[model samples]
Target: MNLVIVGLGAIGGSFAMRLMKQGYDRIVGVDIDEETLQLALDKGYIHEGTTSPEHVIAEADIVLLTLYPGQIASFIDENKDHFKQGAVITDVTGVKTSLIRDVERLLPDHVDFIFAHPMRGSEKKGIAGAEESKFKEANALITPVSSNKEENIKKVEQLYKDAGFKTITRVMPEQHDEQIAYVSQLMHALSVSVVNSTQASPDTLLFAGNSFKELTRIADINEELWAELFSMNKDALLDSITCFEEQLDVFKNALVNTNEEELKDFLKKARLQRKKWY
Candidate 1:
């Protein structure tokens, strides 16, 4: 099968690298930057590379769009005519509900768009930061709508399985957005807020411990990509933020009132809840 990856950034490049290492040689790469396409080829991540997606869309059996959430629908609409008949198209967009509706409406009847989110990434940026191990040891999620064929769903799931993802869960798009808002988006927001809350100089970081470093690690984020993700899932994320702030108020009021019992109960509940997560 001819596999084409669009927007060969960190996730796409890492996926191509993993596929190449697994002896899949039919991989092609599409990107807006000529240098990036050349870099991917030079690195042996793909057999061929192209800047013009429309020129080669018809050649793809599986087209993986690694573009940002905001770009996925428009990209499909612009090149819908060129996609091969019965081809399976997938994406690595983080947020789902709204984008899924737009893409579902825009896709050609002959093709299937199986929306997904690869639950692995890097604090680093672009193709330069791509690492095969990200997918090798990570979990993935697929949010398929009613129009998707069962065979196509299996094909997409098999692709992730082949890429060495440890788990690939199937969930509805609305559920995906809600859960992701809490687990992924809200965590990133918390990390970003924590980092922004203080003016930490080089000297301050020099004194930081393991927990501090660990919590702020993801603070080295891709601003434009995350901003788009945060906006795309605004309602869910806002709900998550509100929930977090209420919890913060609980701790604050305890501290202000010197309520040791309340603080103890809160810490105990937090520890118990965290244990359940594992």
Candidate 2:
């Protein structure tokens, strides 16, 4: 029942905290960020913290990685062989295809690798952003290949549930990436674009309406990490962006032609569609 969580940022820190609160106390955390690791230890999110991946892996029955999309493969390439035999491994990386594909090829047969994405996080970063209930009511997509050990898959699913997540199993990594691109990555790019576009004069900023502010609030983004995710899932994200651009262009044309009827119809349809999700 011991767990090692790598990269103790927002998601990892929150996961560790929730587990400790639930009395799963045998947790060791690993992060390259010294300040974040110290913060996790200080906040009692982790019983221990270290920079050595091998040290952390040696002690745990399960490992949960919360590194960026690009870092996941490199971490596997460098450390998969060292993981304790039969250890259940999983991740919180947003993009799945690349990491899942690489793990399938590189991971030893004895160590199990299951992929997962907890479907929400704040735009905020670091241990300061960690909340014990962050995954409450969040959709955690559990991905286990056919070759994965059935018992281990169940174990990982239980882990997510124990951490307060509502879990859904998704077998195909490619399908996971396609869905995430539209639901997560594309929305981030759209928010970033709007925020950047609206950076006019300060006087113009003061005149912004509530709707404008709400729509573009997520534009305050972590560009470096998101850029990696966007590039990793380029094809899917490009298709999403293109589809959205086409619709936005339709709106643009409506505004130029003073087509109030079409604009109203579009808004009404959008409202109805959004209601379905609620």
Each prediction's Cα lDDT score? 0.90, 0.84
Candidate 2 clash pair list = none
Error of 1 at 114 (Å): 0.4
TM-score for each predicted model, relative to the true structure? 0.96, 0.92
Segments of candidate 1 deviating more than 4 angstroms: 198-203
- TM-score of model 2 vs. true structure: 0.92
Tell me the number of clashing residue pairs for each predicted model.
0, 0
* Segments in model 2 whose C-alpha atoms lie over 4 Å from true places: 167-171
Task: Give the top-scoring candidate (lDDT).
Answer: 1
**Reference-based lDDT, residue 170, model 2:** 64
Error of 1 at 276 (Å): 1.7
Pairs of residues clashing in candidate 1: none
**Best prediction by TM-score:** 1
- Listed per candidate, the RMSD to the true structure in angstroms reads 1.3, 1.9
lDDT tens digits, residues 167-200, model 1?
A: 9999998899999999989999989888887676
